[model samples]
Target: MISEREILVLIPAFNEEGRVGEVIRGVRKFLGQSAILVIDDGSSDRTAHVSREEGAIVVSHPFNLGVGTALQTGYKYAVQEGFKYVIQLDADGQHPPEFLPAFTSKLKETEADLIVGSRFLTGSEERMSAIRRTGNKLFARILSFLINEKLTDPTSGYRALKSTVLQFCVQDQYAFDYPDADFLLTIHRSGFRIEEIPFRVDPRLGGTSQHSGLAPLFYSIKMMISLFVIMLRKKSADSN
Candidate 1:
């Protein structure tokens, strides 16, 4: 029963001034009436200004606090503003606005707590670089094994979340760096329903990925350690 008016389109940007405006406009093209908010993650460029110019409500952080924190900010705003649902998109133009309706419809039909637009799902036409693909496969396997559910794209930023999930995201339990497989596992353990749909993602129109270079290796290591810690904590709690 969530209307478009009750849904917020949240775009998190970091030094993506050249691309954020186009993303905003694209979202507006389809869901023109839906409120669009951009979390400018302390971009040194004109990300905030360009987002504002594109007619999106911009919330700029004082400094770069990472993608997870920026997303948390969006969730906080959604909750405070009384939004019933929130759809997230990247500011780099990889996430297509054309699929916004598909997300909305699927959300309504399934009533899923979270709907992920997965590039690896059936019918998706998107392809990744060999290195990125290999990394994604590794993460996907780990997440599937941990959560006991097959997830094709656990790291995808294109997703829609219900108000309950948004509330959870604003709490202390959410991840702060990359809310990927680890975050999904946490949500699953909490008994939230998650579903994924096939969707194609375009190559980045501009800006560099935060996961490029040695960052992926470091991120993978951190995620593995964090997941282990979470499992141990859960086991202890259950034993008590």
Candidate 2:
């Protein structure tokens, strides 16, 4: 219902040619003129071509950069292009675009710096195991303890942010892992307020779910350690 805000949606896709087009189409159908950008992280597949053909502005990387790199590209584009708001979504068709209206509506009203779309905060349409849900909750608790932020879903990719907030700070420009709560700590250290919006999740259509096993292990160790180091540095900065 809230149409007063202008926001751009950035989708970081890597070899998601089969699924990116549908995502763009769904986003366009739901959010006309809202601007969508698909960052192709050096995908060998037809990701860039399909995205451009589907009316999404495409930015391609020379090779397979991680999700963090793609996101940074999207952030830079959003900042340079004078966009007021930016929502980051996946290109594999897991994010339910139907719920975007609620996220945007809250962003307009709350003036929130970062708005994260949460699955545990609401119902999920996709089938998930209890172990995964428990892992998410326990991780969320740990994140709340470390960062002391009221975050429910630290790993949820469906997230929104004001352009000003995005401009405030970022870390590990290219080598950053999955981001999640650890990356958000960068914003928290900068003293920005983050909001969480409840949303549903759906099964992906093509490609594969990227989060699992060693990738997640890498994400947890590197991203957390990096954030911890940042927290200490931030504390030092505050003292001085």
Candidate 3:
């Protein structure tokens, strides 16, 4: 049984000063005193200050690191603090805190090392742009094939991780930039069980997504290359 003391809600924020406070408050409403930590990735804005005002423990970087690094920081904190489970929520309000209980229940029931909140799983319609949707589907299919599992939303950021998998996340084996499909593949290769739960994702409450305009295209291409590289590295390791 996971106690409230053993769980940590980690929110990674970068220039999300307008939305991070709301996200923190929403989580607090449901989580109720469970440790909430905000990783402020060197936001030039007031993200760290707003998060602190909302009563979350804030860890600010000296400069803007990528999302992957910020998330790894949260994982390292969780491990060091002896948290049994870590729930990762985006600072953007796309990931609603209302559905957090579902993640916890699914993780406990399935004993999954990680549980991803997938917007497509429950027929939850979203208003994503065509280019973004195309990139998402293409990458999801690629990752599903590589992992030999049907992953509906490989790019979904809202996820929960057991302590064992959290340990893996902080290690050097994890990805450095975006923790999308490539990171999921790394987790699978490391022998961790990953599952998906149906989730409803709202459009960002405020602030634009990092992957806007040409960014999604670049991100997709980078992730694809990263995925293949990971596959080759794993194969080579297994042969030795």
Candidate 4:
């Protein structure tokens, strides 16, 4: 079993100055000042400074890269720093830190390479637009069929994974735009083990989602294409 020191809490933030701090504090409250890494994705605001002030290790990008890139950065850092496990959640405050223990416990018990927190599995619904809700269900169904597993929320950002999984994710082939369903599907197809646990998602505390506006429409199309392309490609030889 992995010790607390082997785990890292990674939060990717872009323009989430006020909310990110709260997220950091919440993690510290449970984990007791564990190694919390915040990837400040080129925010024009003081996101980096605030994260540092909250006692999190901050890695700042010079310009705004998408959330996928930010997560890749965090994974890269975790691998380089020799973290045995990584737990990532949104900085928008939607993913509650209270669920961190549940993720850790499930990871320890199942020894799964990846543990995804599902908002739908517990019958708890997060307040989302009708279009987003429909899109999530559609993607979930498709991914479940593809993976041959009963997955409820494939687009969930709250997740925990072993560092060995990051070795593949840090590669250039990993998606950089919106990792969502495509990311999870690629990992699952690559022979990595993935499991999901139910968790409650709170409303966003501040700032707009990168997926706001016409992005969702583009995301849906792009994700479908990406998912199929992943299916066509051969599984990675480097997979565990």
Candidate 5:
């Protein structure tokens, strides 16, 4: 059975050698009482060392797994360690640690199974690339329509999930990037509640963006096609 109320912050990092420490420190400040786990997905830099020095529990992957796999590793750790909640944040420093409270607050207010830190709700236009921002908005709107609930930032990487939500996330064959694309379907299929937390994004402290133009375009298309397929399958099953 899943535990209740406890939180474990999960930091999935890749090649964030310079900014990892600051991001971890920022998170530690907000999560003063919460547990933290840093999944170093085969960083080619000192991300692991820096994160450990900053007081985060560092778990290293043998090779660079995709972001999805890194997240799954954290989730597995949370499940094993008996944590009640998990927060997925980037180590690149774009996702401010100060905004963690918004997610925790929404969790309490709505008793939601998943809480996504959304840039739209908080109104950030500073660093968002036009194409990427437009894609996120379009995807969020599409997901909201599909799930029958408003999702402010469907593709936002900053998010929190209740432990019970792990059941859906851990199934074999579950792919990465679901947190951005298939999150609504995963929760809706499992009868879990999802909420959005408004948060203003800050400019990344160091390193270039891991995703931007071509990455966002490809990812959006892949997710949309997958979502449509799932919906069609669901519809056929329902009708049957």
Candidate 6:
């Protein structure tokens, strides 16, 4: 199994002050504080302060740059800090830190470049709204076909990845906004091995979700366009 020291836990937050702390503590409890980095994407609230108080390494953005950019910042930090692997979870408490160990174990077992946390694989979609569930299925089918591999939940934010994938993500061409199905497809098309595992998600501890409201509809359209663009790109290289 991979040691905790080799792993960096990344949480991207925007106005998630009240809930990010709990997620950080849960990770520290399980991982012994090897490295817990929170990227505060220009949150007007006290996200950075609370994260610091909870003993996390905070990297704040000047303005809200969306979760994808925030995630890239964390990836760059992990690379510079010499972490071998990165485990990212949401700051809103939806992603449980209890499943983190499974990711490391899967890494050791399969050595996959990316390990995606999936709700459909374990039938943990009960927490997702009807619209989200439908969108997930539709995108999953499209991505699976595009990659010629099965994917249950391509939109899941919870995931673990190796340094190789991290290096890929830091490139200028990477998505800076919503990194969902298109992001996964980009990784897969770039020849990174992708795997999925079952993980349970809980409701947010506080605040509304970024995915709520008309955001999902907008995301769906944006993803559709992004996926098409990805398909038009070059094919995969040799798999690692």
Using lDDT as the measure, the top candidate is 6
lDDT of 3: 0.85
What is the per-residue lDDT of model 3 for residues 18-94, given as tens digits with 9 covering 90 to 100? 99999998998888858999999999999999999999999999998889999999999999988989999899998
lDDT of 3 at 163: 86
The number of clashing residue pairs in each candidate reads 0, 0, 0, 0, 0, 0
Evaluation by lDDT, superior candidate among 2 and 3: 3
lDDT of 4 by residue, 42-120 (tens): 9999999999998899999999998889999999999999988899999999999999988888878996799989989
TM-score of each: 0.94, 0.89, 0.95, 0.96, 0.90, 0.96
Worst-scoring 10-residue span by lDDT in model 5? 231-240
Give me the displacement of residue 162 in model 2, in angstroms: 0.4
* Candidate 6, residue 3: how far the Cα is off, in Å: 1.8
Residue 193's lDDT in candidate 1: 75
Q: Residue 219: error of model 6 in Å?
A: 1.2
* Winner of 1 and 5 under TM-score: 1
Per-residue accuracy of model 6 over 149-223 as CA lDDT, tens digit each: 999999899999998998888778786487789999989888899999999988889898777778888888899
**Candidate 5: tens digits of C-alpha lDDT, residues 1-240:** 222238888999999989989888888788787887899999888989988888889999999888888999998898888887898888888899988887777766776788878888878944698887887788888888888998878777898887678755676645756457575665665567777778888888878876755877678778988888767654321210
Per-residue lDDT tens digits of candidate 2, residues 1-240? 344236889999998999999999989877876988999999998999999999888989998879977888888888788787888888888897887778777887895688888887776723555656766776688778877777888878899888656675333432455767676666666666778888888788866767666765665667557766766764422310
Clashes of 2: 0
RMSD of each: 2.7, 3.0, 2.3, 1.2, 3.4, 1.3
Report the CA-based lDDT of candidate 4 relative to the real structure.
0.88
Q: Which stretches of candidate 2 lie over 4 Å from their true place?
A: 1-5, 129-131, 169-175, 236-240
Cα displacement (Å) at residue 224, model 6 = 0.9
C-alpha positional error of residue 197 in candidate 2 after TM-score superposition, expressed in Å: 0.7
What's model 4's TM-score?
0.96
Query: Relative to the true structure, how large is the alpha-carbon lDDT of every model?
Result: 0.86, 0.77, 0.85, 0.88, 0.79, 0.90
